[model samples]
Target: MVNSLSKRCISLLPIYKKVPWKSIVLHPIIHPRFKFTCWLAAWQRLATADRLLKIGVQVPLECSFCNNAMETVEHLFFDCSISKAIW
Candidate 1:
């Protein structure tokens, strides 16, 4: 079984680590919505402009906050002027 190609590929695959559930869910300082948003952002699962383009949304790729930059996860979170102020 160990010598099989399937088992060999499985061994080469990287491990999937999970975040501590207590830290995200059980914490008092973090709001429930905030935790959900954080999880979505971490996974790059938010529907930003770039993702929209990939999914063929056919909309102009402009940052909703800054209107000068492409609306990507990084731009929306860190690079946009308005987001910078929010941070």
Candidate 2:
């Protein structure tokens, strides 16, 4: 019964696609902390403000740097005016 239940749970999991940037993120020269961060970002699993609010944490939705838009991974990394300038 336990074996059957485990199989059922596994089958219910969403199948993820191959991550194209896996090699670059997991390169040996990359620092372990940076590698872990990059892996999370690649998976859209970084604890950005939008994700925090979705999980019911009370956080300001606006970007802390630009205060111009909702704080999402894309916005924080690429779209925010301050980040854009830094990049």
Candidate 3:
């Protein structure tokens, strides 16, 4: 006799939940925005004492979408024309 699909899935539940976070950290193609946001966050974090002091780098920075005006994290993620279409 064959087991139901739900039974098979349930059998793997414990193993699935036990998987470590490190197992997937290096896997590519997980999520495009996840990688991009991580890179952007790292860049912002590592900017510098001088760059942070600059008006442009501090806040209201140029939009990554158009590269023609000021950018905010919101604009980069959703408000910009190019990114809004993507979302």
The most accurate candidate by lDDT is: 2
Clash statistics: count for each candidate: 0, 0, 2
Q: Best candidate, TM-score-wise?
A: 2
Which residue pairs of candidate 2 clash? none
Better of 1 and 3 by lDDT: 1
Q: Give the Å shift of residue 54 in candidate 3.
A: 6.1
lDDT per residue as tens, model 1, 20-87: 65477547889889888877887788989899899888888999887998999999888899988998
lDDT of 2 by residue, 39-69 (tens): 8888889988999988999988899999999
Q: What is the alpha-carbon lDDT for the whole of candidate 1?
A: 0.85
Q: Score residue 65 of candidate 2 by CA lDDT.
A: 95
Q: Would you list the C-alpha lDDT of every candidate in the order shown?
A: 0.85, 0.91, 0.56
Kindly give the stretch of ten consecutive residues in candidate 3 with the minimal lDDT sum.
42-51
Which tens-of-lDDT digit does each residue in 5-37 have in candidate 3? 778888877754443443354468668676555
Candidate RMSDs in Å, in order, are 6.9, 6.9, 10.1
- Candidate 3: stretches off by over 4 Å: 1-60, 67-69
**C-alpha lDDT of candidate 3 relative to the true structure:** 0.56
The true-structure Cα RMSD of candidate 2 reads 6.9
